[model samples]
Target: MAPARPVVPADLLAAVLRRDAAGPLVTHYDDRTGERVELSAATLANWVAKTANLLQDEFDVGPGSRVAVALPVHWQTAAVLLGVWSCGAAVVDTPAEDDGGLDDVDVVLAEQDRVAAVEELGVEELLGLSLHPLGAGMTGYAGAARDFALEVRVHGDHFVPYGPVDPAGPGLLLAGLELSLGGLVDVAGELADRLGVRAGDRVLVDARAAEEAGPVAWLLAPLAAGASLVVCRHPASDQLKRRAEAEGVTATLGLGLDGIRELGRPAPS
Candidate 1:
């Protein structure tokens, strides 16, 4: 019998874990900072588990809770999104600027620099990320917000949701669109097919594309297609070709590199 389709975004991660727990699932790069981080399926799942435990135990996040994520496209952001989905909570992709959409959220997670701005939203449960290469606590941060890096480390490595997650419950919220937990999985599969994300393909995606495409395209779609990701931030255009080659990338998104299979472009000569 065919395996049942994933009911939520977390199921995609579970599928990857079951397939190859030790294989690299998400690889991140920052050219400007000269930082590269790779997370195997098991490692990423552990982070998700810890983050979920922290949210559930500390902030009481659950199926009906709403989380506002005011961060960029990084490996940590992937964990945060998956953690929220695992808990059957809705994630609001809060804008970096102070546009004021977080007033109603139960928790707000923001980068250190953006904590001051997010604090104005009056979210009582606020956490800050340093985005450090080593996942260190926010340096020199003296804000009321809790440190996600420090707090999450003390949580359990395995997560068991307090209750069953409703597949039809709210999952993601963006500027003008909202998707239920089930809808996220459905759209991810559709996007993977539409984008030609073949199974076992190692996909390289630039930060601009990740931001423009959102989580469905940059994160979930690849996972849904059983592909691994090489995410680049502040990508140096001149070095992208070498980086793609080094990463063994079979597909490129938001980058124009010769001999690479770019999205919406003909195969390279």
Candidate 2:
């Protein structure tokens, strides 16, 4: 057999937005912050567009440029990820800590703690993850700096697609640590079918799965199949099981045997 084609994770999401520009898409769940953010196709498109602009205009991220995102699993993370892809650049994701050294990423967008971590890594551009407004030294730290939310707000609601991107393009860079291995999952037609994903299926996935597996089985696979993917911040076994049954999860992916066992045990009927 010929070599398998690479999967560009962002394209899978883009396709869903294009296919049903009016349907439900990503539903964000955050346990730490008790926040739940939902997005329709149109909203996802707008967020991606604004983020792309910020990456382009502020960070100068374009073809071959690399941006390091050191944020945790949340809806903001998703928006930033899609923005990086929209800019036609590669994402270099590191965990919220400094494992060692970052691999030559041009820009670093991270949470407050991660900003300090990336600072030590010597990345050129740094953007802080501020859910609210930020103060002082915003753009004068010998590097371009901006708050994530503010940056998004400054841009227009429309997005202009960037340079040539193939299905084989590099889409994500993921964190690697204890029980955490990260890589990109290409979005293709076949994988979606293999996972029993279908249009309108609300996918409930663990945060760790999304981090480790990139966007394939968790994010892209569902979207590629015309379904909506709901990402939970914390993947408590009982919580996931309850969410699956309550949220009407048609098919779930990225769970290990332990999660499967927890989910499969007969529920009180």
Candidate 3:
């Protein structure tokens, strides 16, 4: 058999955005904040563009740069990762903790709640996100850190990278995981079918668990399969079944559903 061509994260993202620009690509619900937000492929790309522009124009971050992401499992986190990759930059995702080291990163993107801690790290450039459903600025929030919500919007919605992304370049660096730009996409493509995330399917995911699996389960996997996602954070055990039905979920990642295919599980022979 001929070897299959390698998949690239940027290529997959562009393809999906072109194929389903108007369709909803991500639907997110955060139980803790009682927030629900949805983004079409075009909308998500817009956010990615603005973020990338911010990184490039203001921070001079681009290909080969490493940005530490200190945020939780949130929709905005998705945009941040994609934006960095769009600029050919690698993501260093570490939980926002007081002791987390960001000495190696060119910039740091942190959550509002964790801003105080990272602020003391003396990182060169830091952006604090509120994770607001509307992408609003952090309320009554003030600090030396730049406000991502307020600044990102001022950037252009359409992005033009300084140069093409290098598919073989480093893309991500987690504690126990590492992948090149193409390697990340390769894993996503390989897992797409196995995860039961097929085209036209709406895959419901347990945000908490999916986060543990990294961007593969939460972002690239669905796009690699030509599928969309509904990420439920802090999902209510009682409302899962009803929500699945309401969302027309065809597959699930982590969460078990009676008829829905469960991802990361083998299918019946």
Candidate 4:
């Protein structure tokens, strides 16, 4: 029999439930405090669904809408990116360090820490990801920007796609060396199956890949497969190991030779 075709988010998410329905999908590790923060698949899905709904209802994010996510490597980052794609909109991969030429984006989903820098880009609305949920002051607040927490509370976990998306259309947009979309999707499919990544896998990715392979491999690949991803907020030798061990990382999708070496480096004696 021929291999089965991969289902898109709209068709797959509802049927998939293998991941930690109760455990954590994303775990944030703080080297300074040695703290670990977790977000389960169920919870992550809820957030993604709610956030997707808000983006569609409030920002009018749909086909042709480009949203920029300015977040470090973490669970929130993954959720925001997935949420954007779920709405059939393209995700603009903005450098966390710079926000230049973001005028074309209709919505800006940014991190609380980078709000000030993104503000300099002249975006009308900015969504800040907070530690807790807020009930108000999100939708069209202060002209355009809204708090992510507030948006989720008001927006329930129901993601309604504007229409059927063309697989050939732009799924993710990024700036860097150009690569063919067919090649990119093939790589993602290969890696997803090779790593045994499933809806239950809690993957920890090295930022090296996030910059090169684009967010498709780093974010959507596993997400579409029903796996949860945890991106370290910072890159540190010790921190990487702790995150891998603590989060029970099954595999890492590396981008280059240098990243592979760094990921495999031994601990200091």
Candidate 5:
């Protein structure tokens, strides 16, 4: 059978699940914390499901809802974005409650360290992420904010959207960018081609550039192209080549790996 067409964010993730459930999807390295984590497609899907269920059952998040993601580039952030998108909700890339970008958002997902900033948003719902590599709940929060990892565990393993999602509806909302679900898919496809992303490619990327490149490039662009990521939040300059070789990276985003393909720059013109 020919491949099914992708229309929404869920479709893109479903494609990865069907193609490589057990294969590594995201390999995260945090230099600041000396932590590393590798998550497979299936594992990520499960996390997404749990998060979606939490959003649905707890916050009543569904289609047409808006969520402001105030976390940095991390594996948990990846899951959070995918979870929100799976529910057919738009992710508003806002830093604070009074950022003036989004008129009204249903919820705000912020890192524990950044909770104070979003707390002022006055949104009815707020979920705090620990940015933990093992998906652990935040510590010392008490009753300040909803602990994402703690509450998400109570949700079922699978997610079922309350209603059907319209693929042509608005999805991502970022500064200078607004795209429907269909448009997001199209953008991912175009990005994959431009960045030389393809199936079976193990890509090493710098987290800073990934964030600047936006989610379509940092997260879903890889899924959209059947690629896996080795994201380095901060890399020691001397270990770049060694790390790439050790990780079997086929391409790189920012840090130069000898003879490896770099995104956005043509080679041997």
Candidate 6:
């Protein structure tokens, strides 16, 4: 019998882990910071497990819980997103500056530098990520928010949800759109097909595009299609071609490369 279709974002990741646990699932590059980090399916899953445990054990995040993520498009953000889904919680993707509807979120996770801004929102539970290339704790931060780098490592590497995750439960909320856990998986599959994401393809996407497209396109679509990702932040225009070649990118999104098959573009005749 064929493998079962994923019903939630976590299910999609579980499928990837089963297929290629040791293969690169996410490769992140930050040109401005001169940072490059790669996470295999298993490695990413480990981080996700730790994050889920932290949310569930520390903040009591579970079904019906909402986590406001005020971070940029980075590898850490990917882990946090999957972690929230694994807990059957909703991810409220909102800008750090915009706190209009975040008053009721159970927890808020933001970059360390944005902690001050998020604090003003009066959120009780706040976690800050240093976004260090080496996953180090936040330096010189004397704030009330907890340090995610320090706390996450102490959690178990394996995660078992406290209760059954309802596929119909809330999963993602962004830009006036809300999707249930199962709906996210369904849409991701549809988007993968629409974007022509092929199995085993290495897709390169710039930060700007990934941010505009959201996780459904930039993260889940590739995973749902059995593809890997190469996410570039602060992409240098002149160096994109060279970087794509070096990464062995088979396709691209929101970038105009000479030979790469850009998604949403017609195939060359």
Q: Which ten residues in a row have the lowest lDDT in candidate 4?
A: 255-264
Q: Which residue pairs collide, candidate 1?
A: none
Question: Which clashing pairs does model 2 show?
Answer: 7-186, 199-226
Please rank every candidate by TM-score, starting with the best: 6, 1, 5, 3, 2, 4
Candidate 3 is scored at a TM of 0.93
TM-score of each: 0.96, 0.75, 0.93, 0.73, 0.95, 0.98
Among these predicted structures, which one has the highest TM-score? 6
Model 5 residue 259 lDDT?
92
Question: How many clashes (backbone atoms < 3 Å, residues ≥3 apart in a chain or on different chains) does model 5 have?
Answer: 0
Which digits, one per residue and each the tens of the lDDT, describe model 3 over residues 1-269? Answer: 54344455667768877677998888998877777899999999999999999999998888889999988878898899999988889999785443376898999999888888888877769999999899998877778899999999999989988988888888998885789988888888888866667889898989878877888767888888889889999998887888889878888887888877888787666
Can you write out model 5's per-residue Cα lDDT over 70-95, one digit (the tens) per residue? Answer: 87788888889889988888898864
- Tens digits of lDDT, candidate 4, 1-269: 64345444433334333434676556665454454567766777787888888888888888767788776666666668668767877777877657786888888877666676777778887787643322223332243456787667778776777776545445566774322233345555665665556655666666555555566667656755667666654456655765566666665656212222222234234
Computed on alpha carbons, the lDDT of every model, listed in order, comes to 0.90, 0.63, 0.85, 0.62, 0.84, 0.93
Clashes (N, CA, C under 3 Å) per candidate: 0, 2, 0, 4, 0, 0
lDDT of 3 at 233: 91
* Candidate 6 vs. true structure, TM-score: 0.98
TM-score of 4: 0.73
Per-residue lDDT tens digits for candidate 1, residues 59-116, read 9999989999988999999999999999999999876554487778999999998988
Which TM-score value belongs to model 1? 0.96
Candidate 6 or 3, higher TM-score:
6
